[model samples]
Target: MPDFLIVHTVLVTGAEGQLGRQVIRKSADQEVEVVGLSRLDLDITDLAAVRKRIAEPVTVINCAAYTAVDRAETDADAAYSINETGAANLARACAEVGARLIHVSTDYVFSGTSERPYEPDDPTGPKTVYGASKLAGERAIAELAPTSTIVRTAWVYTGVGTDFVATMRRLEAERDVVRVVTDQVGSPTYAADLADGLLELAELAEAPLILHATNDGATSWYEFARAIFAEIGADPDRVQPTTSAEFVRPAPRPAYSVLSSRAWGAVGLTPLRGWREALHASLAG
Candidate 1:
């Protein structure tokens, strides 16, 4: 609740997702109004519904995305519906109502072959349908709502549902040994931490059109899984390191996905805590 940033009513488009729910919970103590609508309540793919629902001047955080990576390879249409067209609908609606649009995107926008963290303005070349669709959404928003904010994050999980953290926790309880991908590297972002950051971004009046926000550091999936095992009182060695080639999927995962938070800090926003510390907090909670 800073004096510089003024917020009244903020609308969330994907309330049922873990990130959306976390943002709503975090907003309780902040000096802003956050209203959420799940897909059941308002499907963003429906332009008529988008216009009908969003008529006031408010800050809108879009969290709805087609996230099924492997499935998206075969279901590109479905992916485009939610990721690209749906985002376009919201952009048009926000522009018409003079509302601020803060769209949540993915680091998958990049090909993941870079040696360092991807900057906000880095050239993008997505490797999967899911990634391509999200990138398309980013472009659509840029064209429709030129001033809208697009924040790209990576490897986000809430230690629930089917996210990587949740899967690791379940495997630790069910099996003796688990093999995680070491060749693939990225920032493991806890959804709660990201939720807090988004709420902070919603309050800021002046921010870059595109920004990258994730945990401070980066690690491979195998290392991240080992860390998760250690946090939950399990043996870290039980998790074995492997490469992406050993475990191929229908859609290729980015070999590297660390997103740079330098842009986020340059804007005078609070830097998110480091990944290991944030992971401990998430498991402890």
Candidate 2:
């Protein structure tokens, strides 16, 4: 808590999600009043409901997003409705109530063609429906809630449940060789770590309008899988590296989505530990 100026109640949307759950858990240790709402509880697309729920001044962290990348190709309406319209509703509500809005975004907003890490002000050319919708949402929030913060993250997993890290663990037990793509590279952000970082942002009185956050460092999917296998006492050698062309999907995954920590550090904000160290700690439990 450290006597940060955040004295208002904190409301989190998408309470059942990986990030939302971690935010709730992290909030328990901090001196803050938090109320978490799931999809069933608060449909952000319903503007009337949003206005009713957020009638007072409070800090709102929005984790609600339609994140099915492949499905988003055919379900553009649903993706935009949730990711864009829903986010706009929250931003509008926050502005009316004088609440601080912190919305979670994805790195898919980029075209994935850059060699270096993505900066917040980098040119954006989303290549998929999902990315387009998220980018739209980011823009809507910026226009509606001028003082809000939009944080774009990549390759997030909690190491438990149905996330990529958990799937890797399941595959390690089910098969000897797990083939993963080598061309796709991004930051691997542990949900718990991301949650801690967001809470830290909440404590600040002011912050950049848009910023990037993730566990430090980057790696390809193949290397990340091998690291996971090694962490769980499995044979890392059994993991095979493949290419994106071999396994096509409805959505064109970004080949490079690593986000830069330069803006994050420049704001005097705390950075999450390196990816490997966080991965080791995630599997330790």
Q: What TM-score do all the candidates reach, one by one?
A: 0.97, 0.97
State the C-alpha lDDT per candidate: 0.91, 0.94
* Model 2 error, position 81 (Å): 0.3
Per-residue alpha-carbon lDDT of candidate 1 for residues 38-80, written as tens digits (9 for 90 to 100): 9998899999999998898888999887888999999999999
Per-residue lDDT over 1-285 for candidate 2, one digit per residue giving the tens place of the 0 to 100 score: 577675568899998999999999999989889899999999999999999999998999999999999999999999999999999999999999899999999999999999999999999999999999999999999899989999999999988888889999999999979999999999999999999988989988889989999999999999999999999999999999899999899999999999998898898889989999999998987
What TM-score number comes out for model 2? 0.97
Give the root-mean-square deviation of each candidate in angstroms: 2.3, 2.1
Q: In candidate 2, list every pair of residues with a backbone clash.
A: none
Candidate 1, which segments miss by more than 4 Å at Cα?
A: 1-7
> Could you tell me which 10 consecutive residues in candidate 2 have the lowest summed lDDT?
1-10
Model 1 clashing-pair count: 0
TM-score of 1: 0.97
